[model samples]
Each structure stands twice: as structure tokens, then as C-alpha cells.
Target: MTRYIAYIMCPALLCLYLTGCDFEDEYNVSPRRNFESLWKIIDENYCFFEYKNVNWDNIYSRYSPEIEEQMSDYDLFRIMSDMLDELQDGHVNLLSSNVGISSYDGWLNGYPSNFNTEVLRNTYWSRSQNYNDIVKHNRIVDNQIGYIYYGSFKESILEKDLDNIFSTFSYCKGIIIDVRDNGGGSITNSDRLASRFLNEKTLCGYIRHKTGKGHDDFSDPYPIYLTPSHGYLWLKPVIVITNRKCYSATNNFVSKMKVLPSVTILGGRTGGGSGFPFTSELPNGWSIRFSTSPILDVDKQHTEFGIEPDIEVDLTDEDIKENKDTLIEEAVRILLN
Candidate 1:
């Protein structure tokens, strides 16, 4: 294995071997083969190189020297994990047997959380103890406003669930859908929920995928639309409360919801993972996942990084001591007026 890798590294044989052989089939489980395979998989398949302005070649140059044939599996995984972190994308991850999985944390690390579920629960539970398990809707305040805290898009949301939840809030003038701390789940769930807010077919975003190995090689952007739900529709004013934890499908939901005339997004910027992620494997049997298809807003801009809120409000220390949610307070004020 060492001899084969050393030969491949030789200037003259490098081009010959890479051009003539299919590296995917050359699963030698050697450090060099696994390293090369992991790097190449991301180079050709992963999206967001151009969008994130990452220099893949430069990254390789910096990290390739650290990969030695004598290195243990743990060391190799650490090096590979560090390489994937350069993308700064939450969807990008490296799963290994020795160290479990590596996750990108910069997306939520530096940003203010802007949400406290305990505070929200305590503040609202005092007023209204009733809540539906299917939709997670709680009627807070004087039963004038409907409050639903949706923590995950992964959870099944049926049309019947929406129907039941809205029925409970029939007398309310407005609704607050809290997506704070939602790390996203299924896009189908996102579409299903967003459909309830639309009156007609709406072009909410665009999606594009790689067509070739080039960094800029992508198919023409295709429009993604949301049609009105056949179920109960909410025509009244709606407020979506978001925070840094709102990601992936949740981000997609917020993007579509913000386009509606009756909806207002309030809170911190969403932790965006707009790319539809696809999985690949390294030669050593480790798994890697990354964003392959980039999603854009109606304006054709990449929301892969994040989508800013209409009104940016943070969770203040004072509010925590008082057991108050500032973002929720702001949303209530907006709905009341």
C-alpha cells in the first residue's frame, strides 16, 4: 500500500495513475487512498465551493502533508474531519467509527441563541394549560392569539393536525409559530406547513445541482413553488419566531412563509442549511455528508449561509431573570396591534 501511494505521489506517475485508474474501486484502506478518496469525493460532488468562496486546492495543500501512511485511524479521522470543517456548513459532517461524527459548530457557536424554551413554557403555561399533542399549539394570553411552538420539521405534521390546531384558535385574531431551536428535518414537512399559508401557487425559491466536476459547474436554477393547501387555510396575520437554531427545512419554511403578505418573521437570523445534503463514503469505510444542491430565495440569492429575520431581537439577560421572552413579547405586541 505504501509503495503504491508513493508511486502515485511521484510527479510523473501521479497523472498516469489518476487518469487511467478509477480511484473509487481502489479501496486499499490505506491512509493515502482514503485521504485522496475523501478529498476527491468532496471536490467533485459537494456544492457551495463557489458560494462559500473556498479554495479546495489550497485546503488540500495545507492538510495533505499531515496525512502519513503510519498514522492511526483516529489521527486520520481527525485530519479528515478538520478538512471538512473548512466549509463552515452545518450540513457538512464526517462520521467515523473511532470518533463518531464531526459537526460544524460555527453556524450557532458565536450567534446569540435568542430563545429559551423554559422561559416560554413557564410564561405561557401559566395562562393556558391546554395544548394539542399533534400540532403542539398552546393558547396563551386572553385566548385572543394562538401560539404554537414547532420545534422540529422532522415531526409529522398532517393536514388534520393543522385543522385541529386552527380550530382551537378559531376565535384568535392572529397566530405565532415559534421555530426557535428547530434544527430542521424533512423538506416535505416544510412544504406541507407552508402550503397552509398560501392562497395561490407561489415561486418561493430556486434549486440547482452540480453537472460537472468544476466548482462553477451547475445546472440552470430551477424554480421551486408552493401551492395552497387543500386543507384549512389561515388568512389572518401570522408571526414566525425564529432563532439561530432554525436550520435546513426550517430555514426553507421561513423563506416561503416570509413571502406571504400576512406573515411576519421576527427574531434572530436562521441557521441556514439550504443545500439538499447527499452522502458519500471514504475508502476506509468512513461516511461523509455534504450539501450538493444549493437552494436560493425568490431573488436568486444563496440562503445556504442563513436567512435574516424581518425584525432582529435577541434574548436579553434581563428577560431571562424576569422569565420573559423578548422575541415572543415583540411578536405578541405586533399581533395585538
Candidate 2:
């Protein structure tokens, strides 16, 4: 048995000898592979690269050395981040460190979790949340209340100009706003989106970072506000539909809405990814997204843990299949009552 094992080892070592590369060379291959993996994902997934001045060749030369030297996985992620900044598309990006708990463990163990797991999970949650690409305009329900569903925080949705939408909802029994699939987009969009909901302008929430917390006015910038706006639905009871998938700018939307006198969050705990991720593309074609802006609540509590719902409602698999929405039913019932 020992002789047979030695014979097998001898051939394997002989092959390595012929290759003229040792363990160090083999180990280095991993970093390059990682770099390639990221680079390729972007090349395939990004909507457009020409607009971002994507010079694939130059990107590789610029970051290969830095990426190669990254001994720690976290540092390697940083290198990937630095590389992805070259391409400026917000939607085309990477995931977070904490959210990647499963992936990190799987990678280290060599068994590795599937790459699309998070995306798939989030996408499934989003679908379950019943998110639509475009927010339905505000309309009266039974001539008593108004309703609108803004599935995402992307400003593009509001680019159509929301002045009309807000104007329409000015008078109603109450307003029901749904943001279950909002994964978050521009904070500027948050400002404008939130602005449409305000009747009296005042401090909303504070913006914080790894440094600490802050409370800048709406005009201050992303998450830079303490003064609250009466919210367009000030006179109208504002009912926000939330779920575990509510995250980032969406969570910020919820956190701010919580402060409004008229707003009541109904549903589940929000999806916990907060903070604005600064993004860039790598030479290998992978785009990286990292949190650059930290968001805090009125109490200066960061939204990373996600905002809890006031009315805590959930959806069962049956709810999903039967196309039945208990949350919406509850909202309509509350408005009617």
C-alpha cells in the first residue's frame, strides 16, 4: 500500500517539476483567478461600458500588482473595489462583506457557496414583495384615500417628474406607499422622493458614517438631514408597506417616514444593508460596490440593522401562490375603518 502511494506521489511531483513552478506560484494563481472572476462578471453583466470609459487593458495593468499583494480576503475586496470604480454604473456592482457571510465561508472551505445565492435570494424576496419597475401614480381608493407603490428608490422612476403625482395625492383619506422591493438607489432620489411626501419642510433624519452621526438639512446631501418635512401626506394618514426586503435607501425612506406624524410602517423588519456603497470596476471586468455613506435614524442609530415595522405583517407561501396580499388588505382595512 505504501509503495503504491509513493508511486502515485512520484508522478505528481514529476509533473510539477516539468511545469517549473512551485507552491508559491500555485498560490499566486488564486489572486489572479479571483481578479479574473470579478472582471469577467462585469464584462458580462454591466449594461454599458463605453459610457464609463472602460479601458479593459489599462485597468488590468493598473491594479494587478495591488490585487496580487492582498493577503487578506477583505483587503482583496478593497483592491477589487478600487478597480471597479472605473465604470460608473450604479446598478452594475458588487455585494457587501457582512451580507457575504455564506460566500466567504464557502470559499475558504473550498466547497464554496454558489455565487448567485445572494442575488437570487434578494431577487426572490423582491419578487415576493411584488415590486414593479415603475411606481403607480397616486389615485384615490373609494374616494377616501390615495395610494402609490414605489417599488425601488431609483431616481429614474421620478425622472418623469413627480410634481403631478404629489399634487394628485394632496387630498385624500390617507396615503398608502409601498416600498417592499426598494433595494435603494440615489440618496438624492430619496431626498426628492421623500420631499414629495412632505407638506411642511423640517428635519427628517441624520446622516452618519464610520466617524459618527450627523443631521444636515434635506439640502445638505445624502442622509444629511435632521429637519423633517411635514411630508406630502401630512394631512393624510401615511401608511408605508414594508418587508424584510426593504433596504438601503428604502430603509432610509422608512426610517425617515417613521418620524412623520402621519406615517405608520406596516409589514416586516427591513433588509439590513444600509450605507451608500462607492463603486468602481476592476481590470478583470468585475465591478465592486462598497459602503461609503452610513445612514442613521432620528436617534442617531444606524440603519444597518434595518428598520423594524410598526405593524409587523408577514406573507405565507400561500399568500404568494394565491396572489393574495394580507398586508395590502390590512392597509385598505385600516384606511376604511
Candidate 3:
């Protein structure tokens, strides 16, 4: 059996690798064959089948009959995309040059958008004296509290960037790290930013890969840890502001920070995408990306759905009208008191 270590972060373009199984003979351009290939690819690797309580065999029974040799690519794509949506995962996507991309975004669609970029930038972040593409940092609330707005994890954060940010906040009582509407990018950035808040090595989460074709066949969970950065550290009160849009790498960051004593996760629950996504190609030249490995919180619990905040907050219409972010105000209030 071949084994590979899966990284627990979300990158812009995830590296794709062929599955260990040989499909040379099955690569013919038949609709049924391609349908089976796609189903089998997901059946063998998708991490959430058992966790989500999906009946894959039942799903096959229902959809397999729909495949026809003469079916249009649009029809086939619709069926396959619908079948994938049954998993209700945001990380799952099917891409075809002929039909475009199909994805399940219901994970974030129905929830309240607790974050507003206009309000954040115009009301609060506009006051920042220091700003960069990766982060916006400044002292606010009578210069007693430090504020940092990190919009995306895709951007890299150098040690000097964090060093400067922390040094600027050295005199403040506490810090607010707002990551609302951050759709996630790289886990490397998440860890680099998180390391500064830790005083020691800590167990942040666990991850396991599918070891066999069985939905339940998974390796023992491996512990994930966060070690303190050698650079400046923040041992004082720290508030992490999150929302439904804080997904993928952002979700992982919140999971890690929630376990720390000095950090409090405020705002709404994180938009979770805890699976380490991997890609597989179908015989028809189409490709699918899905959650391949399951990542659990420090307690060995699934955060695939989301991680709850210590204090749940939503942006109010009144607050929006006044150009105030309720979550930020709440964080400032918590940090100040």
C-alpha cells in the first residue's frame, strides 16, 4: 500500500496527484464509465462520507440509472454535480472545460453575513495609520487596544511583518485580530500568524487520511501542534473576530486559537472547511476536487461543519447604517474590560 503525508492547509491551487489505483482500461469515453469513475474516485477518497452519514451506495442506486450513452455533457454534468452536492461540502467541486465548474456553496449561503467590508474599512480600519496587503494594524480605542485586519490567508506573512505589528502594539492592553469574510488561502500563513500568540508548544488539532477504500477505513489521528515563534510573542489578552466567511485555512486557525488560554474567539461561528482537499481526474478529462483528509480539533472532534465562537455576534442593521462593525466593537469592549 502506498502512503503519502497530506498537508493540513488550503492553498490557492492544491497539488493534484493520481490515485494509487490503475484506471487505464477504464479511461474510455463512455458516459456510464466516466460516471462510475467519478463516483468511484470520490467514494474511495472523500473524507466526509461516514462523518456526514451519506449513503453512497444508495446515492449510486438513485443516480447511476440516470446516465445514458447519448446524454449531453450538460445533462451528465448536472447529474454528477447534483450527486456531489448531496455531500453538502463547500470544498467539493467538479470542473470541466466543456461545462465549467460546479460547486456546493450552501455552507455559507444561508447564514447571516456578519461582516461588511465597507463598514470595516470606512468606519474602523480607515483609522489605521499602518496598512499593507497582508494586514492592517494600528492602535485604536484611545490607543489602548491594537487592531489588525487580515482579509486573506493566501498572502504570505514574513517574520518582520509580524515583528513590526507586535512592536507597534507592545504598549496596548490587548489585540483584536479580525478575520471575518476571509475565504482562506494557505495554512502556512495561518500558523505563522498564530505562532506569535503562543507561549509554548500546544496541541491544536488532529488529522487522519483514508487508509483503505472503506468509508470508515482511516489511519489513526495524528496530533498537530503549534510552537511559539522565536520572534515577538503576545501573552496578553487576544480576541479573534470571526464570521461565517472564515473558512478553510481560517477555520483551522480558529480551531488552533480556541485552545489557547489567552485567546478568545468572538463573533459568529467559523465557516468550516476542515478537510484537506485533494483532486482526482475523471476519464472524460474532467477533474474533481474534494475533502480527502479529515481534520479534528484538539479534542479529537470534527470541525468539518464549523467551530463555534466563545461569544457569538452578528452585525446589526443599525450598526451597518452607522458604519460600525458590531463584532469589532464587541471585541474592543471585551479587550478593554
Candidate 4:
């Protein structure tokens, strides 16, 4: 039998694989069947089992007995959600209109939320003379440093927008890009933003997808490159502010930026969701989204947990009381001296 492979492009430039088997036809709409279906979907395609040290067979042994023909939908959802939580990934979620969305936030639960939007707006951006929907840009610290607040990657970033922002800061000594609390949205947008800082085509990361049903089944990692933008470029020193909320595409952005000679990451560690997520439907018509492809950093290392900052700084109570963003202050000081 000849096996054919096809690709579906998802956010973060992830490739989803469609192989020769019809795994969906093997199950029915019973409670036990749905349970098996969910388990099998993750078993066959979820990418982090070996990396995370999870014995999926043992997981099957533990959760299989919980399924019953007469169990309530809520009970089944609870069990399945709990099972996914064992993966401890923020990108994994189970969605149903009946039970709403079941998510696992263990990835961000205990990490310090080093970002405070109120402090940022009131203390920093409030002084900005110009702002737009996607980015807020201005000069700070006696008008010697440029500061840009990019809250989310969901908003579209255009070349003209970047040109305008960079032009405004042409004379500044350096720039600060604050991506704290950015939950992530589009990898295309993140890459577009990162391109402005690059001087050449650079290998930013790698990605691979499952080629078989085995836990270790995956293709050779493919190179992911980021080329310099043709429009505006900033070769000056740059400091990126990050926090626990920087995940998915945001995490990818940080990983790419960290490799550049002119970029320095500051603040807390990022919230990592390095897997490219894919969706599969259960027998009951509910959908489950999970990590199917693993993405690696420039050194071929897994950043599934997160990427540490070059300079780690957290918000102090005293700084909070004074309405000062410690990370921003540190970044400004670095840029100055």
C-alpha cells in the first residue's frame, strides 16, 4: 500500500498532516466510544508524549475504566478534560456547545503574571503622542528612547504601519517592544513584525509532524526561516519585554527575536505553546484541539515549557505602588547605558 502525505497550513506556519487512514470511521456515538475516540486521537497525533514523559498507554489504562454507557455528558467531559490536563499544555482544549470549552491552564497557573496593563497605560503609553489600533509608539525618557506597545498579534500589522512607527523613532538611541500579556494570534503577523529587525535571511526554528501512529513518529525537522523585511528595518539595539502570557505565536516571535544579535529579551519567562495545534472531531460531533506538530528553537531544542529572558526582571510591590513598570525601567536603563 502506498501512503500519501498532504499538508494543511495552520497559524504559526505549522503543517498539519493528512495520511491514508480514516480514523474517524472506526468509532460511534456511545459514551465509551467517544472516550476511546478522544484518547485515540491524541494517542496517534499528539506530539509531546515522549518529550513530556507521559506514558499514554498508562493514561489509557487509567481513563478507560471511567467511561460508561449511561454516564452524563458533563461527567464524560470532566474525565476527558482531566485526561488532557495531564499533558499540561495551554494549547490543548476540548470544545462543545453543550459543555462550553474545556481547557488546561496549568502552563500559566503558577507563573508570575509580570504584566500589568493599567500600569503600562497609566505610566508609559499615556505619555505617547501617537497611537493606533495595532501599536502604540512614542519616545520616552527625555525623548531619547523609542517605546512600542504591541498588545496582541491578532491585529493585522501592515508594512506602512511599521514604516510610520520606525520613522517616528529614527533618531532614538534604541527601542523597547513590549509584548507582555500577548496571548498570541497569527504567526504571519508575528513573523512580519520580527522581519523588521533582521538584516538577512536567518533560520529561526524548525517544525515536524507525525508520520505514523507511534509516539516517536515524526518527520525530520524542516527549517523555518525569517527574511528581512523590504520596507522598514531597525538595526539599532532592541529590548523585548515578555511575561508568562506570551504564548503560541508570541512565543514563536520571542524565539526568533532572541537569535538576532541586536535583540535582548527582558522581563519574566514566556508562556510556551511550541506545538502547532490541530483539531479532530469526536464521535459525538464535539471537536478537540491538540498539539499535533512540535516546533523547535534555532538550536533544535524544545521550548515547549518556555524561553527564558536574557535579563530576568519581575514586577516588585514597591514598583507597582509607584506605578512604575520595572521591566520597562530596566530596558530603558539598558538602552541608555
TM-score of each: 0.90, 0.55, 0.90, 0.90
Model 1: which residue pairs collide?
none
- In terms of lDDT, model 3 sits at 0.89
Clashes of 2: 28
Worst 10 residues of 3 by lDDT: 1-10
For 1-337, candidate 2 gives per-residue lDDT tens digits of: 9999999899999998988765442333256687876665554444323323567668878887776543666667667666765553232355544323111111112221112223323322333322244465445444456666676667454433455555665666677777766667666666666665556655666653333211211222334553333433345677888876666678878888888777789887776555555565444333465444455677766566568788877655554455456576577778778
**What does candidate 4's lDDT look like per residue over 133-227, in tens digits?**
64788899988899988878998667898888899889999999999988889999999989999889999999999999899999999999999
Off by over 4 Å in 4: 1-28, 129-134
lDDT by residue (200-290, candidate 1, tens digit) is 8999989998999888899999999999989888889999999999999999999989889999999999999999999989877789999
Q: Candidate 1 lDDT (Cα, whole model)? A: 0.87
Over 4 Å off in model 3, which ranges?
Answer: 1-27, 129-134
The candidates, ranked best first by lDDT, are: 4, 3, 1, 2
TM-score of 3: 0.90
Determine the backbone clash count of candidate 1: 0
Please give the RMSD of candidate 2 to the true structure.
18.4
Hey, what RMSD does candidate 1 come out at? 8.4
Candidate 2 or 4, higher lDDT?
4
